[model samples]
Every structure is written in C-alpha cells, then in structure tokens.
Target: MATLDGNLVSADDLLPLALTNLGHFTSMRVDADGSIRGLALHMERLVKDCKAVWGADLDTGRIREYVRQGLDGQSAPCVVRVTVYDPKVDMGHPADADEPHVMVSVRGAGAMPPQPLRAMSIPYERDLPEVKHVGLFGVLHARRAAQLAGFDDALFVGRDGHVSEGGTWNVGFVDESGTVVWPQAPVLPGVTMALLQQHAEHRIATVTVEQAKGMTAAFATNTSIGVRVITAIDETELPDDHPVLSQLRETYLSIPGETL
Candidate 1:
C-alpha cells in the first residue's frame, strides 16, 4: 500500500474519491525493485511545494518513513498518490475552518510502455506552476487535444511561445553536437532530469523552439514514463532510424519496469 497524509493504506480504502474542489494529483506504477529510485527527491519537492502553496507543515522525513513502513518488503509494482483538497464545508464555521484534504495510496505494480512516442504542441500553463497541485484540467484538455491530433501525448508551449515541457512530462533533446539540451525556464524540476543528467554523455540547458528547429533527437522525462523518445515534433519529420533516440530508448528500457 502507499502512504497518504502521513498514513498508510490498509486495503479497506478505495481511490478515485474526492471531497472538495482543490482537485487531485497522483503518481502510479513506481518501480518495485527495492530501490526507491527517486522517492526522496520527489518527497522533498512535494513538501516544499505544499508549504509554499498551502501553508502546510508537511514533514518530508515522516512522509518517507511512512512510505518505508508501508512498502514493507512488498516488491510488486506499486501505485502511490498524495492529494490535497477540501473535504466538506462546515456551514457557519469560520473561513479558516476548511481543512486541506490529503491521502496516499499504493498498489501492486503494472506495465509501462517503452516505445518512443510522437507528440504535438499545446498552449497552456498552470496557475500555480510552482506547486504540483491536484488541479490538472488544463493538462487533461491538452492530452485530449493530442489524442485528437493522433498523438499519444502533448508538449506545452508557454505564454512566451517557447516550448516549456510536456503537459505531463519534461522535454530533452540532442543537439547536432550530440549534447543533451533541456529547458530551464518556468518548467517543473523533474527527478528524471537528474537521472538523465547523471547518465548523459553531455547535457545542456536549452529551450523547445531551438530544439524543434535543429535537434537531432528528443525525448520526454518523468518518473512514470522514465524517458520517452520523441519520433516527431509538429510536422518536421526526424529520421525514423535516428541512432541517438534509438540509443536512449534502449538505455531507458534497461531500468526494470520501463520497457518497450
């Protein structure tokens, strides 16, 4: 089971449940090889974001301890979620009486696709870009737009008309020099970004427009997807047999659950 609100699930609980309009946020299919991979980093960011956005005093150490206790040696694929929203409004209660609803859940692991993905760009931005909030209506809409365009996922363009990142993942590309270039603009700092940087032969900070125009290859990053190589961006066709993308895909699959 997964940890939620500093507590663990006991198999009697169910998900897809919500009480307030604060919305919901989730992460699933965590690799179960006894290695937390990037759990600590993710928890750190979550705590920081929560405090900054919600004035919540979340303890990262306690959160990790809950996860460790709940993990309890079950090595199957696991799903975990932490959501904050309004539970119920207390009529006539003080305005500050609203409690922030939160929960964590985990389940056995599942399969993750390893194929290189093709993506199209969408125009959207998060109202609170700093916090990874449960509110994801814009992201859902963008994903729907990608589906309409015959793509599996969507890349997001910011207000400045520059490529920011994916609606649900971060973007990285290989320049002509074979250096891995990624954006450092108002984008979410992803745990996968750190992993890729450690593994890449070369890494640099760059924007999406520069990458779309001249990148030799590209990919999306996230804990859920790990790394999804981009086969095409907009209408520009990259060579189907690009070696750089192929190598990244192969290397990515070597990680337990993320396989093609």
Candidate 2:
C-alpha cells in the first residue's frame, strides 16, 4: 500500500518519480506496534537528504503522520519506505520546485537469506554517496553483473581501489584481532550501521581490497537485513560464522525500537 502526502496515492502522483526518478528515501522495518529501530536516524537522514537533494526542509512529525496513515494501524510487521519527491518538478527546472511531497509505501517484512553471501568487488561509486536517492540503475546493474559472475552481490570499490560498500548495504569487517572495522570511504551512512557502531567497538579506516581480503570475516548491514555474514569477496574466502560477526549482529538486533 502507498500514500502521497498522507492521502491515498494515484498513478498521476507517481508519474514524475517514475519518469525522472529524482528523490531520496529511507527504509525501515516497522514492528506490529508501529515502532522502528533507529527511527530518529531515519528521520535525520530524510531531513538531511531532502536538503541535499531539493534544498527543502522536512518535518519529522509530518513524516511520522504519513507513515502511520500508510500503516493504517495494521498489527503486522512490515517494511516501510518514505520517499520525498516533487511531482510538479521536471528535470529541466528542478530548482524551481516547491517543497517535495512525501510518499509512504508499505510492504511485507523481509529477512536476509540463510546462506552466506559471496560478493564481487567492482570499480563503481554512487553519484551522491551520502543520500539514499532513487538513482539505483548503477547499483542494480552492478548487482546483476555480480550475479551473472556467480556471486550474490557487488561490493563497490572506489577509484582509489579502496573497498567502500555493497549494493544496497554497508559492509563491515572483523580483523584477526576481532576488531570491527568500517571502511573510511564515501558511502551512504546507513541507519543499521550507525546503530551497530553505537554498541560495537569499531574503528574507521581506509580498507583496500587486499586489506579486506586479509580480514577474518565480513558482514553486510541494511535496514531490511539488519546484519548478514559475507562469506567471500572476489576469490578470498571469509569465515561465515565468525563469533565476532555473530556478536555484532546480536548487538544490532538487541537495540530497542522507538514507537512511531
């Protein structure tokens, strides 16, 4: 189900986004009680991205209202995505657009696959690494190429040959010393990653592909998956069941969700 600006959305309301695909969004898993983990982070992301993408200010309270209206008091766990875009804005004159409208879409919750993921590192970088924008063509293309190459997903490597992130997720590594290491590169600051960092002892450093390969284990973090072990990158194999990775996942899931 979907709503636009707290009202039921129609096809006309989505035409601009479908055509231009210029917007930013944040996804979250909402419990049956309308609560979500890192809810404030998500709101901050939306507000920040709105300013970056459209130079507009967004109210978190209004976003919460729209989300609740979209959920419609359903007592079932689901995934919710709030998209901010302006239907009246065309690519030719985006700067002339007014405050962006919000679109709240709800769907059934999802979990990571039981099997560990194998990723292929590719030289690619998102246009705006900071915003969770609707520009996903490059991301999906990379993922598809990795899948065709017998891998689960694509791990993005910047031009500098430093490992940055995975398709639709942030990547974390566990070194031989059991230290959690996050790549110090330009990538989306994912909510799940932020939540894990708050509770996990971690350090940020520039991790090249070779450095990542030397790590004992790796994992992917996103709103939908929370945390999932990455068993391999390129030809290098990592421990799928590393105790440190398990502890990090547990620490992430243990975070309490805030009520909407």
Candidate 3:
C-alpha cells in the first residue's frame, strides 16, 4: 500500500477520500484457511457506524460487492484491508468527511516471531472510539518508538490514565486472581479479542494502568498474530516459564491452520 496526503492510497482515484469521515469502517484480515473470520461483524458495525455519522442510504451493498470483486482471485493466507471513508459528502466538505472509499491489498504470509513481545506506555486517543479508520500515524509512531526501545510494540495510555490497547491489537491481562481483564475504552473492537473471549475461561473489565500492574501475565490479540503474550511492560518482566502465557500460546497453536 502507498501513502498519499498522509492517507493509505491503493489507486490514484481513491486519494481524495477521507476514510475517517464515515461513521463506521473495518480493517480485516483473511487468513490462509480461506476463512473470512470477522468480515460480517466488521460490515455490520460499519453499517451502524456509517448510519450514525452519515445518515441512512449509505449503500453497504455497494461496498461489499466492491470487496468481493476486488478479492476474487487472491491466494490463500493473504492479508486484505478494506476502508470506507466519508460517504456523506463530496469534495466540498472537509477532507475528513465520511464518503466511503474501498481499498484492497495482499501480502505473502510470514512465520511468527518466537520470543514474547515487550511494550512501553505512550499517549493516544480515538476520535470516534467506535468504528475503525485509516488514520494510523499514532500507531506508526508507537511502533517506531517500540523498535527504538527494543520491543515489538507500544501500549497506548489514554488521557484518562488507562491502558487502551497496543498499536494494532487489543490488550489483555491476567490479574493476580487469575482473572482476565480487557478494557473497553481507547481500543478498537478486535476480532481476535472476540475469539479469545469466546475461548478463554475468564472475565472482562474496564481496567486502568494502576490495575495493570497487578496482572501476573499480559497478552494482545489480532487476526494476524492471533494471541501474543506480553513478556514485559516498561521493564516489568513476567517469568519465561509463566504457566498462563504458556497455556495461551498452546491454545493459540491448537487452532487449525492458524500459524503465522
């Protein structure tokens, strides 16, 4: 994917659309097993979001057809992304209007990283806090900072001093009581997190950074990475032999054809 005017551009004509102006959008990944995964849920949310922001008659059927045609002949185990921008206005409105624009791209699958990742805290905020969008400068910045700090990614600390999420994944933590907690704010509704919620015998809560320290184990979830255990956070390291993370890793690997 290419960047034009700070937005992800797959074709020249899509350059002018503001992906964030729409009420709802989705960023989904199609794995090698030919599974669409959370595409339906993403689309459902997109409709609700688009309706809230742009009003009715957003024509989601048009968007779905666009995705189907765009990905008709792609290989298995590839990554696909579709963005719906401002659908309520044309060129006259602000650049961030919600006229929807669909974009698609694919990349070859790669092996997963073995070592557990570490994360550091950083600042971020979601404008809508409901639907996904194409603006990711904060994620890019956090990833760069994580690389410089010798880690895989960064955990966003929202203005309310709560743990929001990782650059591209939803955050999870196993508290000292052996309970799992996932905060609802400052995070996108992740498909992988939904899967984990279904699979794990755990609980969920709107957690805080101070409460995060009481966690004995931490991890993140995304379609690409599945479930990734967090070994360290800001110099606080969990034991390599921690059983909770080990079990989560094992459960993750048990999924058929889920390898990175």
- Give the candidates in order of lDDT, highest first: 2, 3, 1
| Best candidate (score: TM-score) | 2
Model 1 residue runs over 4 Å out of place are 1-19, 23-29, 69-75, 84-102, 107-113, 198-213, 239-243, 246-260
lDDT of 3 by residue, 1-260 (tens): 42222244544445445432332446555665666665656667667766665554445576656655555677765665555454344555654453454454555544443457788877777665555755566678888998898887888888888888888888888878776778767567887677667667777677776677668888887766666778778877855455776676666555544211
Better of 1 and 2 by TM-score: 2
Residue lDDT tens for model 2, 10-128: 99999999999999999998865768999999999999999999898999999998988888865567899999999898879978886799999988886543367899999999998
TM-score of 2: 0.96
TM-score, candidate number 1: 0.77
By lDDT, the better pick of 1 and 3 is 3
Instruction: Quote the positional error of residue 7 for candidate 3 in Å.
Output: 20
User: Between which residue pairs do clashes occur in model 1?
Assistant: 2-106, 4-104, 24-134, 77-108, 77-109
How far off is residue 78 in model 2, in Å?
1.3
- Displacement of the residue 234 alpha carbon in candidate 1, Å: 2.2
Q: What TM-score would each prediction reach against the true structure?
A: 0.77, 0.96, 0.77
In model 3, which range of ten residues has the least summed lDDT?
Answer: 1-10
Candidate 1: C-alpha lDDT: 0.64
Cα deviation of 104, candidate 1, in Å: 1.3
